[model samples]
Target: MKRIWIIGLWIGFTLLCNPIQAQVINKPIVVLDPGHGGVDSGAISINGVLEKDIVLEVGKETIRLNRELFGNSLDIQLTRYKDILFSFDL
Candidate 1:
């Protein structure tokens, strides 16, 4: 009786945890913004490395890692992939 009860509980838990199939509509959008770019060098480290460059590099790496791990499971978008002039007045 105890074995049967445990089996029943396991089955119930499995069913509860399983993903349900829902009606397909539209997928959500994921936006990735790597802050600071162009004329805006952002912060400058003691080594003279620009914060914008570091942020961009890290962002790209993150995107790559996400792609490798999630594949098409997620929709990823980046604000800026390359360096560009952001503002002349900042």
Candidate 2:
């Protein structure tokens, strides 16, 4: 539970800070959703940081990594590219 979130945060931060290089390929399509947006902040940290914020960064970082580190081999997309909340008003 907590451990998983912590580890995920660490991995996201690490990948964001330290970049890698790989060959480019365009075949797979990846979609990521940063859970609990808008009014729901999901989990909260001791420092008052919200889980939504953390996961949002992770999602963005995943896209960045795919483009820069992995040479765009993956077509990564996010449910919400911004910090805005998702709505079912479609």
lDDT of 2 by residue, 22-82 (tens): 2224257788888888888999999999999999999998988887987777878789876
Per-model TM-score versus the true fold: 0.60, 0.65
Question: What overall lDDT goes with each candidate model?
Answer: 0.77, 0.81
lDDT per residue for candidate 1 within 1-90, as digits (tens), equals: 999999999988876776442211233457877889988899999999999999899888877877688664445677889997545485
| Candidate 1 deviant stretches above 4 angstroms | 1-27, 87-90
What are the RMSDs of all candidates, in order? 12.2, 19.0
Clashing pairs in 1: none
Per the 3 Å backbone cut-off, how many clashing residue pairs does candidate 1 have? 0
lDDT of 1: 0.77
Instruction: Please give the distance, in angstroms, between residue 1's alpha carbon in candidate 2 and its true position after superposition.
Output: 68
